[model samples]
Target: MLSAYLLVSHGSRDPRPEIALQQLTELINQKQQSYSSSKKLVGLAYLETRPEPLHIQIKEFAHHAVLAGCDSLKIIPLFLLPGVHVMQEIPEEVALAQQAVGKDFNLELLPYIGSNPGLTKLLSQQMAEIITQAWVLIAHGSRRPGFQQPVETIAANIGAVAAYWSVAPSLEAQVEQLVAAGKEKIAILPYFLFAGGITDAIAQLTETLKLKFPAVTFQLAQPLGASAELADLIWDLMKE
Candidate 1:
């Protein structure tokens, strides 16, 4: 009985997230190879942008996995926050997939990638190399009331203020607050796994922020891309 692991993400139309996910998939596969045999399976799935919904994707992947001798499967959500998708949608999809897959199959939904404390530590390490008096930890925010808690917690852990891309306490607002607090050198870390349209928009916003706050210095860090370090995190998420 083989155990197959599938990394699921909020799908994108830009193609970059998909590319990064595939790279991550490869990295996880490489790590899996190191600790285990060549018999296991590692794959990628999406919650959107495909013709099929997530449950269907999970079902199809599980079907393929079973054919490849996989009896048990773990679905790991690659999300960075415990947003609506993580707290509600993904688990619902997993349950639907579990129901459809039936008795003999073992389909378990693992905790999301963002739920790991190691993630904040990784973010801290990323900022350690950059010189800044203060930091703004930004993410694509959720409309869900308590979703900002994780972002705030991570920011607090890293000695930074929190900002959201699509919600209140935006990057502009955060920068203004820092500038008002006498911070001259500030850095912004994108709390994402890869560079996407939102990251580009954040870069543009930084350019605008620089013009707005000419006296205050600003630096923007890359999102946690598909590096071995991130792969190591994903590898840790999957016990297979």
Candidate 2:
């Protein structure tokens, strides 16, 4: 049986998002306990732009797993895709960590959450519920716009399902266009976990727009938290 777990995420400069990841880790552990009490788990780190680098975090996590008598450690990257971070960065860091820890530990890397169809459906449902006029799904935009298409796809699916007036907008551009066009009611769904700086910036922008377009009501749908669907998603990943 697997004795411990480690969840690695692309850490945020905003501490609040990191705190949200910790909450998710606890939620995962709580669900895992149903299978066995012996398994122990903790969230480790990796920062795209932060103080604690990926390699250092992995070493610390390996120590925790080893000290906990873990023969096996499940490494789940809490990300959407198998992009640069997942393909190159995490694997390289994990390799270094494995060399130091030796072959006694079995390391299993689970697939990203974005690959889950169920989660995509859930996101669509959430988007449909929030928007009566139009939707601009706000994501943590990447330098590579191609990486953003999954979010657009999810938004399109929501529009298809609802048959509602919605357009997928990058947080930077279409938001202002919609406001200018007299879109009466618009919802900006932050496709993120926890309220942080991005959410704050979103609020400021929308509120400023609200002053200009008083008729347009901007509501933010909360991120998918520790919901049953998310819990089941994690459970399915563990089973794999």
For model 2, the run of ten residues with the poorest summed lDDT:
160-169
- Per residue, candidate 1 scores C-alpha lDDT tens digits across 140-172 of 988887888888888888898989999998989
Model 2's alpha-carbon lDDT is: 0.67
Name the top lDDT candidate: 1
Error in Å for residue 75 of model 2: 1.2
True-structure lDDT of candidate 1: 0.88
The local distance difference test score of each candidate is: 0.88, 0.67
Per-model TM-score on C-alpha atoms: 0.96, 0.79
Q: RMSD for each model, in Å, please?
A: 1.3, 4.3
